[model samples]
Target: MAVLNEEQEMLRDMARDWATNKSPVTEFRKVRAAGEPQAFDKGAWNTMAEMGWAGVIIPEAYGGSDFGWLSMGLIVEELGKTLTASPLVASTIAASAIILGGSEDQKSTWLPRLASGELVATLAVDEGPRHAPHSCSTSVSGGKLSGTKAFVQEAHGADLFVVAAKDGLYLVEKGDGVTLSTRKLTDQRSHAEVTFDGTPADSLAGGGESLLDDVLDRARILTACEMLGMAQQVFDTTLDYLKQRVQFNQVLATFQALQHRMADLFGDLAMMRSAVEGGLQALDSGFGVARAATIAKSEANRVLHTMSREGIQLHGGIGMTDEYDIGFYLKRARVLEASWGSSAYLRDRFAKLGGY
Candidate 1:
């Protein structure tokens, strides 16, 4: 387990309580039932902002607590355990891009609102099914951006979008010249396919390929943390089921074969934890972050893939039903596995980065 300072531990405990008592998996179901344009509760988001979650990484001068990425990761992991749908990660990523490369004027204008959660933002990188960074076809001319960005997370109500063009990232607001077509993902969360035609954009100061890459690596680390939470939830839920579910004159947990399978999952869980912690530490200390992020996301892709499958297998037929929460993990696992970069994608990236 990762050792935390007193504040980090308290943040983790508070996040856990919030997820359990307020925004459990059922909350997602409720939002989905209510339909589009209201994918998540704005009130809940405001509550999170009040809790200082939105500003976890922003500097205090910009109206944030400046708690750093590790603290943010802890909160995200707890939320992931319940499959809570919020814009914390997406907004954080967007804020980071600004923090790292934004002009003084840009920072002074955006950071405070972002910290207050009065403005929401997300990154738009993919133009298709694959996660190709260099192949971006988005064009920029005369301070206007024209292109299509797909798989934009938390875009339903985002105030700003950090879009990747052929050259670099451009800030595009949600207004004229930008059209959004909403898509319902497998996990019942909403994403947008945005088309920007001559949308006016503000270029980030000192922004280039390297800054974009750094933002992506940071996003991957945070995402890996969430996947860690999801995997842990699946394991814990499956274990509880094993203990309570009875068949053939004994509890499932009593069977040696099932116990062995769970034991293996336990080991995988430990590795996942270490990978996530390593990523966080690397980012915090500015040491080996690229390698650490690749490792963390790759481990997340593998562990979630395995645990989600095993959770369903152990639950048998009941797991297949919509009523069962185990099935939700499988759907979310598939999306997360595909998002940013899959295990196969990250493996190739790692090899290439190593000059192999």
Candidate 2:
């Protein structure tokens, strides 16, 4: 088990308190009801930036806190508790790509802005729904990109886009032949079907197909950390509910059958935590990040899928109603499961890792 240091623990506690007090479930409810992706409270976003969360994983030279991947995961978990809707994950993935493969000039221009939250960026890699990075059909020619990227999270509000095209990785600004058509997704945040019609773009010099693979690997692990947080929160919330909600003259938590179920959930959560921590360490150590990320993400997906459904099922009637906050976690779990790569997709990748 990877135990956090004092500083990391403090950071996690601070994030937990902030998310609880400032961006609670009620806030998410308001944002979802408003039918706006930008409905994420601007004040909260600014606060997160000020707290240095936006720059948690970016290097210090780029105006970031440089807290490393584990620190980044701690904050992400807290955000999941509130079902906070924002471009944090998308921006982090984009920033990591730029740092890992972009030219020095590219880093100088974008990293600081991204770290400071002055610009929101998202990576466009999914051409269809299969989560295959190599299957990208978006083409680049003469420094221009053309194709449509579907299910782009926060695309409606992003200021910069790090797009993956067939020729290589390209950076597309938010205008000039770039059309972003916002699509209302089930999770109720902003997603878009982006059409690039010969959009002017800047290629990431020296970044080829390997860059896409690198980004996907990092993305998978980062997303797994976030999912770990979400799963933990759902488990904790469900456990709390069982303690208080009485049935048959006793709390539901007292029943041996329910106790056994919670015990099983505890075991799964522990496994997920270990896997995600290992994946994060592997990424930081420059180990086999792709395989480790696939394992972590695949396991986390199974854990969250089971926990989310079980959370609602255990809660009985209140779980199905929007009046309760548990449903929000369930909805967010489904969305996160489909993001980056689905469990089915990751399992295939894991098999490839094992040479099966």
Candidate 3:
């Protein structure tokens, strides 16, 4: 874990408390039950905005704390622990595009509302079923963006979209010519396939050639933070279960075999934390962010996959039942594993970046 400053520590602690008390897995269950297209409670989002979580990465002049990525990661990790379903990650990344590339006039119009949680935004990159950002076919003709983006997270609720086209990133609002088709996946969060047909679009031209890649790097690292939180929760919960579960008159936690398994998981979790924190720190320093993000997300993928699987196996039958909370983690883990970039996809990117 990274050594946090006083403010960061306080922010993390406050997030932890809020996630535990105000937005637990039960709250997510309610969201799933409600089956809202947005897949999150509006009231909960309002509360998050009131507490300044919606603006953690925005600049102070724009009504944000400009607290940096690590601070944002801290809050994301806490929400991940409780399986909280909100647009925080998607919205933050979308805001980052504006921060990095939007023109002054664009920023003046959007940043304040985004920072204050009045305007919800999400990124739309992939044109196919997978995250092949380079293969984008979406194009702009006569200032109108047109194409279909698949499996866009938080699309159902977004008032704006930071969309990727063949030329560059563009901003398009949710209105005429923009269509959405809901795509419910294992995670059950807000996801949709958005089709833009001659929708008026404004190019985010300032960040230049690297704008999309930079924004994607941010997305990968932020997503990894949430995976880290899920892995930690699974580990803690499984350890507690082993101590309480007894088989043949011997507590499972007392068994040498179980102890070894937990020890291995503990080491893996530590490594995941190091990678994730390094990525967040990289974002703060603006140094080697791409490489750090790849490592962070890759480690998160490997460790969380193992942790969630072992958590279910260690719990036996109860873990498989719908009535249990552990099963939800496993389901969410699978969906997140495929988001941003899958393990195989990331490894290839890392290798290519190193010229190997």
User: For every candidate structure, what is the RMSD over all alpha carbons to the true structure, in angstroms?
Assistant: 0.9, 1.3, 0.7
| Residue 291 lDDT (model 3) | 94
lDDT scores in order: 0.91, 0.86, 0.95
Residue lDDT tens for model 2, 1-356? 68889999999999999988988888888777777655476677778888888899898988998889888888887888778877788899999889887888999999999898888899898888657677888998887789999888888778899898887788899988988877775677878889999999988866555888888887888788778878888999999999999999999999999999999999999999988888888877888888888888889889999999999999998898978888877777787788878988888878887999
State the weakest 10-residue window (summed lDDT) of model 2.
35-44
Candidate whose TM-score is highest: 3
By lDDT rank, best first, the candidates go 3, 1, 2
Q: Candidates' TM-scores?
A: 0.98, 0.97, 0.99
RMSD of 1: 0.9
lDDT of 3 by residue, 194-241 (tens): 999999999999998999999999999999999999999999999999
TM-score comparison, 1 vs 2, better candidate? 1
* lDDT value for model 1: 0.91
Q: How close is candidate 3 to the true structure, as a TM-score?
A: 0.99
Of 1 and 3, the candidate ahead on TM-score is: 3
* Model 1 lDDT-worst window of ten: 204-213
How high a TM-score does candidate 1 get?
0.98
lDDT of 1 by residue, 1-356 (tens): 87899999999999999999999998989888888663788888999999999999999989999888889999999999999988998999999999988988888999999999999999999999878777799989999999998878888879899988888888888899998888878887868899999999998757565888888999899999889999999999999999999999899999999999999999999999999999998888888988999999999999989999999999999999999999998998898888888888899989988999
